[model samples]
Target: MEIKAYSRITADKMVVNGSTVYSSSDGENINLTDLYRHLGIDYPKFFKMDNLCKAGFLGAETIIRDAGMDTVTPKKDCDIVLFNSTSSLDDDIAYNNTIEDDANYFPSPSVFVYTLANIVTGEIAIRNKIMGESSFYVLKEFSSSIIYSVVKETAQETSANAVLCGWADFLNNTPDVLLMLLQRTGDGKIQFTAENINKLYR
Candidate 1:
């Protein structure tokens, strides 16, 4: 049971390497709609995942917008669990660089807001109006079994129909995001196997 999606965002481009679509990228300042159109994703139906948006030309927001919204039946339940290695290092960098005058020594609210890795989940919730359970985890490595255990417990206790889980790590000016939208069938069929999570980037 393996479901995977991989996305890459650089200075002026967005790339989605996944099953539903082969590849897609766009230039700088093209806006979300244009990026989606270039990626061949349905526009109106893809209004979700905006929470993962980033601040720059090509950032997390671009990745989330490009990933499109997960397609689930109405009233379907889902949990969004995200993990990042550096946890808003870029925001911290920006905050640290915003100087020159004593009056502006304090961090800007906009940049400060993104300093937390978990803030992206809230952005997604606000955009899609999703009120389901949400969480964030930070670890040296993304262990499949560890995450699987967490997901299992969340599903059993909350009766969640699905789990949008993945690793979103940014380092040294490079960001890598891999997301898996997993659904739990009534038969307890977990489509994502340990091996699948291991091969998420592939």
Candidate 2:
């Protein structure tokens, strides 16, 4: 597989293919909604997503658009494989807060739906019409080898034409995301490898 395009999002900046596309002001935290509006994206459901989903969605969307995949007809030949360390703890805390107090018990189904880390992949798939295999793995920490192995095996076993895979972790109002679009045949020069993945992630 070849790396077609990649995007990264941190607390104060968004980068695509080694270039800084957007950056927040000094000492100011990056607001996902403001970034969404700044990017001119028209997805309304974005406001309803938790921070984890928003970070992952924005990363995936930026890479897809950077790779010029958004203009093409949606296809099911692409798979999504994402890795994170938090495992939806951010949203889990919010969900728990809603039900912790017995007198104020208000379990929100909307918030409950985002308690799983894989929900980010589902949101991206639904938006892009990607019907291929979608998986999310929570590792103790970022492991480039594991990511490379899973992505390689998934691509080979499923015979998928492409794959969107990377790390997305958000917690305590902090975000660290690195999303990449990989394809079997493309003009891109970056080879899909653990070393390259590690380099780009850093």
Q: lDDT by residue for model 2 over 1-202, one digit each (tens)?
A: 9999999898889999999988888778788888898888999988899999999999999888777777347778999999999999999999999999999999999999999999999999988888898999999999999999999999999999989999999998888999999999988689999999999998
Per-residue lDDT of model 1, residues 1-202, tens digit only: 2243344443344555433332233533324445556556443524432223432212323344444553232324767777766677766777667754687776566666667778776665554454668888877776777776776676677777656666666555444566665565433333576666665544
Residue runs of model 2 more than 4 Å from their true location after superposition: none
Clash pairs for candidate 1: 1-191, 51-123, 51-124, 53-61, 54-60, 54-61
TM-score of each: 0.66, 0.96
Per-model RMSD to reference: 6.0, 1.2
Candidate 1 least-lDDT 10 residues: 49-58
Going through the candidates in the order shown, the clash numbers are: 6, 0
